[model samples]
Target chain A: MQTVAHAVIAAAGLGSRLGLGRPKCLVEVAGKPILEYQFDLLAQVPDVRLVVGYMEHEVIDTAFQLRRDITIVRNPAFRTTTTQQSYWLGGLHIEEPCLYLDGDIIFERRTFQTFLSCAEANAPLIGITEAKTEQAVFVAAEPDPRTGFLAVTGFSRTDRSLWEWANIACLPAGLLKENGGDVFTRLSRHLPLRAQPVECFEVDTEADLELAKAYVTRLHGAGTQVAAA
Target chain B: MKPNTAFCFDLDGTVTRREVLPIIAAELGLAEEIGFLTQMTIKGQIPFEMSFRLRCRLLAEIDVATVAKIVEQVPVDPAIAAFLGEHREQCFLVTGNLDVWIARLAARLGCRVFSSTAVVRSDGRLGPLTSVLRKSTPIRELRGQYDRVVVIGEGQNDMPMFEEADIGVAYGGVHAPAREVIENSEYVVAKGETLCRLLLTL
Candidate 1:
């Protein structure tokens, strides 16, 4: 049986790049809140905990209005921290495999569905999108010609290069618990873990939001519902 | 903070399970005018106040007695009624609606009502109120007075007040809050009874 997993959403950061006075999660792309779109999909699966920091009231109000069953945790250090810290704050009380989502990104529902399906199947999958050179943390991958297994070398931090931005991930509880607070402090240490990739979207900047809006317009034009990866 | 406390609620989705404005307008046979404004509000093309004023003018052709009759057809949540009745002294209704039939509603719920109104002349034609209270004003005032204030609502208009409250609850009905509010609220509840239950428990 695939036990229902809990989801931890890191919505602590004020996405300044988006230039929307409020948190990025509050920004509306389509008619729905981006965070709700994330929660709505996760709500269908099972248990979820939303970790909120800046603009916590707005996020909790909406989530609670959507479904009172959602557990909300506060992160006081959101302003001075990275997403890794936000993840750790929510990760502290979690058990079983949990899904972690970046509150800003919006993607197709199938992307998240695939992540859940993979998690259910015991496959650790990481959602990935092509990032430009400027937007990438370049890590070299050796695609084995025979076995087709891509072996990752050491991590190389890049600047201004578009690469895969991992929007969502199905992480086992052990990954969170074992790492503890150091998870954000030590993500650079784990180069091999960035193996599997899925459809990923980034909403880090105003340009990204406009791109997403246009993307959504096109997707809806083709009669598709926007889902998160 | 001297336990600053005030009960602020939205009329349509928060107290009732649906949007009462459209229902009331429809009942008064001004469905077309009200419906158009409502559609515009939902589409984010116009602020709620503009839409509300236009609807009230359309319904103004009808008598207050007819509005009361229509209000009778509107369903209110029993638990919400009980909550308001019990907390009448502390509760205050803050809505974007004109006071077409709010007098009866105020008497029934036994809570103070704060709404915009279209003034009726001696001849029974209506004119606008001195000033309309935007959704956040009540919350801002309540927050200033009380150490604690909570606003329960379900819609885009509720977003500003949702930001002002110490505890903000998004009620799911005709429209849910923007996804951002949901993610940030202290609690999110669907029905009025469930919301009342949670409030009492807290």
Candidate 2:
């Protein structure tokens, strides 16, 4: 399995849905800031680059103290743009099969273990969840009855789907050359959804943040279990 | 004017002995809050300028007399100080430290200083202006203003300015950066005097 050297965490949006005065990434979900947990996870994997905006100093300072190995980049346009712009602004720092983690996510350790297992398998992986209660993004996955390769396909149109996008993706890092936008932007145009059952989760609202905190705590207490897809 | 080259020099580590705010915060008993913010800024959890301004505002609550007394304990890099004195017009002290220190530093070095300033009330309570002046924008603006622009510093805050400068020197005498800034800089000089003595050729 080829190793990934640079994991890029995009943290440049005012998560208005969270209703916090600070950026969603800066909001403390448990004892740790949501972004800090993500950084801790990335520190376990490989070296990383973080793209930050909004209250950037708080983000940068917190991250640096956590892991000095990270490469900090800025996206000052966070106020008026989307995560796609933030990720694209940090494209130059991408190298290897970069794991792109949304800064506002909280999940089980098994979720990451499963993703890592799938990631090392050389197939481009996007962390997806089985627990879909809200308006979550997901991919349709069913055995192709004939050729036997999993058929993963779904976009914004397929609201009622089997699996939801956990807001985390793993790309070859060079895919940006093929399409100039983010993973979703390029995948929406180029590839169909390929599903892997990893319980990755996204935290959008304050309720979601609380849920994530509890879920992650439970997952940690139970220990990791990597599901074979 | 021969297309004045704007030389942006970071105050702490680059121009001074140590990180000024962190030191002052330690002195004023706000080290815990300030330290947390400092860690966040370096970690990419927060912006450098904002954290810096926040620290300044926190420190400004103390009297100017006390601050000046505390600042007296602050040490300037003699080599860089002399270098700026010799090339006064071209060099600019670009720091996130407050205006009081900026003015004091500029006067001491005989160069212009561009930094954030806090509003001190008659009752001596300090309040931050909160307008973010990014260190990166100033470097770009200076680059446009001058035939050449150079930046010197150590730490993640200096990454953008270092990336844009015609001559980027990371003075890592106090705290050496992990690897990113070390690799990005054109020159890495740890000794303050060694870097100053070498700057004559450039």
Candidate 3:
């Protein structure tokens, strides 16, 4: 198993659905920008890339202040594309296994680290969490008889399952297409991928924002005494 | 294997951490005055050749040695300097700046450099500009020697360099690149480390 060092964060979306008038990564939860949290966890990652589009300056300014060494790839067509496109554009031509995640969500620190650990050993892995968001593409996964870890069987919006696509994965380069249904749709081609569980709060609506705030507040209040990611 | 690629860098803001001229102006308390014109030149508000002559005249009030001293002291982008040090043979510094002003700085990287030349009067004062460097001249000159040429710059003056290269990268390490330069480039990179990484893997 190869070690993982590269990571791409799709922070280009307009966040029109969230009605924040800003990119989701800038959304402040518990008085801190979500990007700050993402950077704090990604401090160990050597090569981190961001695809910026909507209010790119704001994102770039905030990103540079966090880490001066990060690589920024622009998504000029961000208005028309999805996060999948941002993922492809951000990770352009860098041929290696890269950890991919959306900027609209918050993950438990310990669990996210565990997922990265699993990703290093598993290579191509899917991250799933218990269904908790308002709108989600549910994931159907089953235990791989050999490894005993759940493997992502399929993703469907209509299907109900205990698992939901966390929109996080460690994948080989060139697997993503510039125009794809979504991250899961592209990952679906390589089925039965190993699935690792993580605790995440994905912000899509006003309600989800409240949930994320409370989640972070709880984490801060409890410290490491709480459940692991 | 990647093709033989020549990396061309604009000296002022792209390679240095700050615009070179302003630092020289600061010595004579003309930083703000020269800084304004530098910004205008970068945005294409002033024709590069005309502005170069005018700035040269304004900065000529200072002795030639002082000008060189100021430019040499300007901080460089550490990551980019390291990249140039490692690939000096393939790396080239292309600048619209005068050669005399940047010679010491260029020697530090140990790379081939192209710049506008100027004369020095017998009294040790700077003379008039001998010629102004056209941004794309080096790209054309290096085309036969290398399989590909990649240009990096941050101002409107770099538009031609962007057009001539196989790939152009708009750099924004010091400040946001000119909008047109960003549009002309195949990629827009914000951090020096990112720019160096892209150079390594591109």
Query: Which prediction has the highest DockQ against the true structure?
Result: 3
DockQ of each: 0.05, 0.04, 0.53
Per-residue alpha-carbon lDDT of model 1 for B131-181, expressed as tens digits? 666777777776666678877777777777788787777666445556656
Candidate 3 C-alpha lDDT tens digits along A106-146: 88888888888877533588899999898999999999989
Instruction: For every candidate, give the share of true A-B contacts it also has.
Output: 0.03, 0.00, 0.53
The parts of candidate 1 lying over 4 Å away from their true place are A1-229, B1-3, B123-125
Q: Which has the greatest TM-score? A: 3
After superposing candidate 2 on the true structure, give the runs of residues whose Cα lies further than 4 Å from its correct spot: A120-123, A131-133, A144-149, A177-183, A220-229, B1-202
Worst 10 residues of 1 chain B by lDDT: B193-202
Q: State the TM-score, rounded to 2 decimals, of chain A in model 1.
A: 0.82
Task: Put the candidates in TM-score order, highest first.
Answer: 3, 2, 1
Model 3: fraction of the reference interface contacts it also forms: 0.53
Q: Relative to the unseen true structure, what is the C-alpha lDDT of residue A81 in candidate 1, on a scale of 0 to 100?
A: 68
Model 3 misplaced regions, further than 4 Å: A224-229, B1-3, B28-36, B39-46, B60-66, B119-125, B140-147, B163-172, B175-191
Query: Weakest 10 consecutive residues, lDDT, candidate 2 chain B?
Result: B193-202
Model 3: which docking level applies? Answer: medium
Which DockQ value does candidate 2 get? Answer: 0.04
**lDDT top scorer:** 3
Scored by Cα lDDT, where does model 1 land? 0.66
What's the count of clashing pairs in each model shown? 37, 29, 1
